[model samples]
Target: MQTVPMVKQKVHQTLDTLPPQGLKELSQFLDFLKYKYQAERRTNIVALGGIWQDIPFDVTDEEVRALRRRVTDTLLSKV
Candidate 1:
């Protein structure tokens, strides 16, 4: 993949400056963005915020956290 110059810098800057509410809004916006474009997904996994490596769903936070823990445990066992 071709790297977009200044992409990381600008993304970090924007995320860092977001207030809590803005962060929530950004999260929702990202959720929509991912869903809208998912049919065109090329890779097996899609990354977000450089660090996150999965899709964020509309499920409750508790459910999401549980899933994350499961994925972490499974990945750790594999390595």
Candidate 2:
């Protein structure tokens, strides 16, 4: 069985040889895989809608923007 590094190396080698159209297809496939994986792993947000109803919070637009930037950076770092 191939290890994670071996699989990644094989993927990169294949990607390097793909043409523009092949690369586009690969990108779309990867996006689909990410979406499918996330969908399967996600909780049903609607079912938990009222779980946080007791919490009170208020924030300005600047604070929200900064929080979003920080969260995005953190998530991207994991990739």
Candidate 3:
């Protein structure tokens, strides 16, 4: 595997050879990579914490399951 410095040098060399449009495309691709990486690192529990907090603590397992099914159905229907 290439070291970090080696990777940086290679990237710079490649960037130098790219035309203006290629550089723009590379910038967009880098942004997408960063967004995808950050999104993958986030946990579902962390994402839903605030959204689920309003639900009553006494809710039963069955209710949760039913809600999940309804949500899945609704989402699948859209697809």
lDDT of 2 by residue, 24-59 (tens): 999999999999999999887443247666665656
Q: 32 in model 2: Cα distance from truth in Å?
A: 0.2
lDDT of 2 at 7: 100
Task: Go through the candidates in order and give the C-alpha RMSD of each one to the true structure.
Answer: 19.5, 16.5, 7.8
Please report, as a residue range, the 10-residue window in candidate 1 with the lowest summed lDDT: 45-54
Please provide, for model 1 over 18-70, each residue's C-alpha lDDT reduced to its tens digit, 9 standing for 90 to 100: 99999999899989999979967766653466445455645799999999999
The deviation in Å at residue 65 for candidate 2 is 49
Model 3 misplaced regions, further than 4 Å: 46-79
lDDT for position 62 in model 1: 95
Candidate 3 deviation (Cα RMSD): 7.8
Q: CA lDDT of each candidate? A: 0.82, 0.90, 0.91
Residue 16 shift from truth in candidate 2, angstroms: 1.1
- Badly placed stretches (over 4 Å) of model 1 are 1-5, 40-79
